[model samples]
Target chain A: MALKPLGDRIVIKQVEKEETTKSGIVLPGTAQEKPQIAEVIAVGPGGIVDGKEVKMEVKPGDRVIYSKYAGTEVKYDGEEYIIIKQSDVLAVIE
Target chain B: MALKPLGDRIVIKQVEKEETTKSGIVLPGTAQEKPQIAEVIAVGPGGIVDGKEVKMEVKPGDRVIYSKYAGTEVKYDGEEYIIIKQSDVLAVIE
Candidate 1:
């Protein structure tokens, strides 16, 4: 099943953290906080403003950096997906 | 000191949770996660869209609901505030 966001909503899939630390130390899930990094998977069409459409700056393939705590996490089809507005995105990664 | 948001940025002050629960239970900080509720304190003038300015729908006095994990938390002048884009706002409380 595909989830479609309304307005300027975006769907992102979080990047899983590495199981082993840089020093080759295995870390458990409860060791520390979960990583919040994510990859943009889909975006809604441009948002409507004053009878006009505002195009988005980021695209589907763009890797964006957003607020670590900025989005609603939802489990769809047994996969975790985050729904955030375009404005929540802080920067685009090259 | 006042925080001025640039472009579509918005400044919000988180609402502190009550110390005592409804049943008069004093919960510790570690007992549960912190409440993510916030109140909009200030908003940017407007957002630039397609060479035009799109006026914001929300205002300073409006209570807005946003993603639980959305926005960067910043501490300024001994106070905590969140800087998020207007698009991060999901709904307005009437």
Candidate 2:
């Protein structure tokens, strides 16, 4: 089965904490609330959401940081993925 | 001090559960969770938010139903308020 997000939503796989630490990227969350680093797997088409126009900014393969509490978790094909809106993505790592 | 929310945000004061029960309004939350009924105290001027254009829907004095985990709580002038995005407000109670 395939997963397709809707309306500026994105699907991502969490990257290991050790790998993120090795990259030396600073996370925005506090010690008790550490933000997550993940790799973009799928991106939704930008369109109107809640009466507003949203443009997708991150593409598949891009690594991004997002709030820990943002998005919904889904399990598919024996793998877990997080589905979140593009707006919840705080930063993209180059 | 007064709270002025920004970008489709709203400030609300939660209504007591007893009052809601007496009003016979069915809440959306499950047995373990209960959605809150709140009175709109302040509304933000909707505009560009996360690159999207948002227009405020609820105005002051409107009662609304919101997610239990949706918003940030703040104490101002010895009173408590919840600050949440307009999208988090599920419905306006007439």
Q: Pick by DockQ: which candidate is best? A: 2
For every candidate, what share of the true interface contacts is present? Answer: 0.02, 0.06
TM-score of 2: 0.49
- Summarize candidate 2's per-residue lDDT along A1-94 as a digit string, tens digits: 1555555677789987788789886567786556889999888666777766788889999999887564655444456666677888889888
Interface RMSD after interface superposition, model 2 = 12.4
The reply for model 2, stretches above 4 Å from the true place, is A1-48, A51-94, B26-34
Model 2 chain A, poorest ten-residue lDDT window? A68-77
DockQ for all models? 0.04, 0.05
lDDT of 1 by residue, B4-86 (tens): 88877789876555622221222122112222345788888886754666667667876554553457889988898888877
lDDT of each: 0.61, 0.74
State the displacement of the C-alpha of residue A58, model 2, in Å, after optimal TM-score superposition. 32
Model 2 lDDT per residue over B1-94, tens place: 3899988889999988787667655444444334567899999999998877876767899886665575899999899999988776644544
- What TM-scores do the predictions have? 0.43, 0.49
